[model samples]
Target: MKLIVRHAPLFALFVACGDPPSDTGKVVAPDSPSVIVDTPKLAANWPGYYSDTLPCLDCPGLDTQLWIRSDSTFIRLQKRIGLDSIPEGIIGRWHVVNGLMTVGYTGDKPEFYRYTADGLLTVDEMGVADNSKQDWTIEKFADEIGDAIPRMRLIGTFTYWADSQSFQPCGAEFSWPCTGGMDLGEEEGEPIVRFNNADLQKAYKQAVKRSGDPWTVEAICTLGMGPAAEGDGADEYIFIEQLPRTIERCP
Candidate 1:
């Protein structure tokens, strides 16, 4: 069983609304290092992102996306949902260790990924295999609050569904998954089951008017690896775009 870590415990509470007993004593580290991401690069031939999970179709859990910056700052997003909402918080970062591109949190003590030149992110660091970096997904955001939180204003009764900006998941093996490499939902060749970015926004508004239920949406943005299942390494590829999720409504 892979352990799926969230962006922030606070975000979880706002979205899901049930705290495990272990959440009570969780201490917030006083000082976390600032993650200065410089962007990652994708294969010149295939410079785009994909979604790992089909959003709206598979919108109930953690959403993610793949991001490749120009300077070779490879990234994968986790704990994201929706594609057109505001952001709440972010927990992941991009890093390079010993010539390997890795994704992790910005912390004094953080998990790191070592990417192969091909760009498939994996874990060989020798710890927490159960929570290996491979288990993570990436998502693109419309805004910092696209990781939207549960909140209710005192004087106003504006219902805001939990949602995020635009993003995608790096797919198991593909390139330019969505239309123009973003979640347009109208990708002529995309799976019919997956919903696109526009549909996500439509759903969010409908939910807000109806019941303020937060739904998560995402695509697995990945580097081009293949039609062959035999290859698995960072060097294989990278991705862009992200899915967002509106978990719950804040009263």
Candidate 2:
């Protein structure tokens, strides 16, 4: 017997029992009951501002500010205290697993954090708390931080399903509808011009071995609100600016 796994209009994956499907599609083993893959929801009090000054070997210290949004996305800002350089900002997806939170960035190893009575404490990759730590905890803020959305490079799998194109960012559970274009304006300002995404679409199509197959890709992207794929309300969408190449898998 075969099971028809449907991801809510995204795609209908046929899973064969006993024997794996000969097709090179990514499918869970027959023993697993869940067909839909989604990241675990964060705790109620997990969405907030977390900050700390970490010890730096070559500098005075590293001041870090992390904003955990309710949308599973995060903004991180870090600055060397004594350096003249400006603070570096990074945007990525955050998820919780096994009572620990992991922040994943494109092409970077994930960082883990464990919830504590006071706040969130830094932990190793194996979820072990630092032993000889000198204040590795990040204090939580009561208020939210106001920061602009920054364009970021994303590594994800692109799929053309149900006549719609979507991208699933690496380490992210949900896939967002993707639009190919370049916005030439400030984050809050109205975009004056829009660039076509013919090349990007062409690259994605060429990478797919079979129709409706998901292709791992790397691209520069921006997040914005748009019409939902199947609903009446709006949802967050990924705007692709540049498609570099199709990667073998998520790095």
Candidate 3:
């Protein structure tokens, strides 16, 4: 099978979650016996890239990559190994509160972080951490994020099914040697192409000629970073691919 995969640059792997206002509002001073001189400078050292392989319930582990910028903006990329699915990204605004950092997004849950001597560490909602915990630790890297995230490789056979009303493209998760019905509509942008009648007819005829059988299609796309934070819009797909194939049934 011919492979058509793309590995977006480290910066490209970033996805903007949603814009949440910066949490830089002034903190009301507490009335206490002791006086305070100045607020801490946590945000100064907070700009950089961090990554880790955390525990996963089903797959090998969750590969997480995060980028924190000086302007209080951040982006994150998450990938699930053993599952041939697309990598997901999030972009948002971030701020530090009493040494704890909060990354806010639109609909999903927020992520928290804390500063460390070596780098930034992922923490729970309460801003606490156990020194012995290393699973969620991400070390600071050079400005460029090259070679931080590992590329995902996928090889499989895809089948095309169509009718007067709809077109369905299905793909398998693992190699062709495995047996099971294919999963449909798992692609990130499959729905975007369904309305094109000309393309649909072309693909449908080719699949039918191949006896509606599966054909090996190798595709690779990157889930890279979108526009900078506070930019105008978000991309519907962080990753995309154009499969190069001469349709033929698998033997």
TM-score for each prediction? 0.25, 0.54, 0.41
- Clashes within 3 Å, all models in order: 78, 0, 13
* lDDT-sorted candidate list, best first: 2, 3, 1
Best by TM-score: 2
lDDT of 3 at 31: 40
Query: What's the TM for model 3?
Result: 0.41
User: In model 1, which regions exceed 4 Å deviation?
Assistant: 1-69, 75-93, 97-100, 105-198, 209-251
For candidate 2, give the lDDT of residue 34.
40
lDDT of each: 0.35, 0.72, 0.50
Model 3 lDDT at residue 219: 29
Q: Sorted on TM-score, highest at the top, how do the candidates line up?
A: 2, 3, 1
Q: In model 3, where do residues sit more than 4 Å from their true spots?
A: 1-44, 107-109, 130-134, 144-251
lDDT of 2 by residue, 1-251 (tens): 33456544244478778887676655544443446556554454778888889877789888887889887778676778888344554557888878788886755778889876567888987778877857888888754544434455567888875568888877665777887875566555755434445655677677787758988877667667777867699877778776666788875
The CA lDDT at 160 in model 2 is 77
Cα error, candidate 3, residue 4 (Å): 62
Write candidate 1's Cα lDDT for 137-205 as tens digits: 222222111121121111111222343232222211112222212323555777533544555456556
The TM-score obtained by model 1 is: 0.25
Residue 234 error for model 3, in Å?
A: 17
The prediction achieving the highest lDDT against the true structure is 2
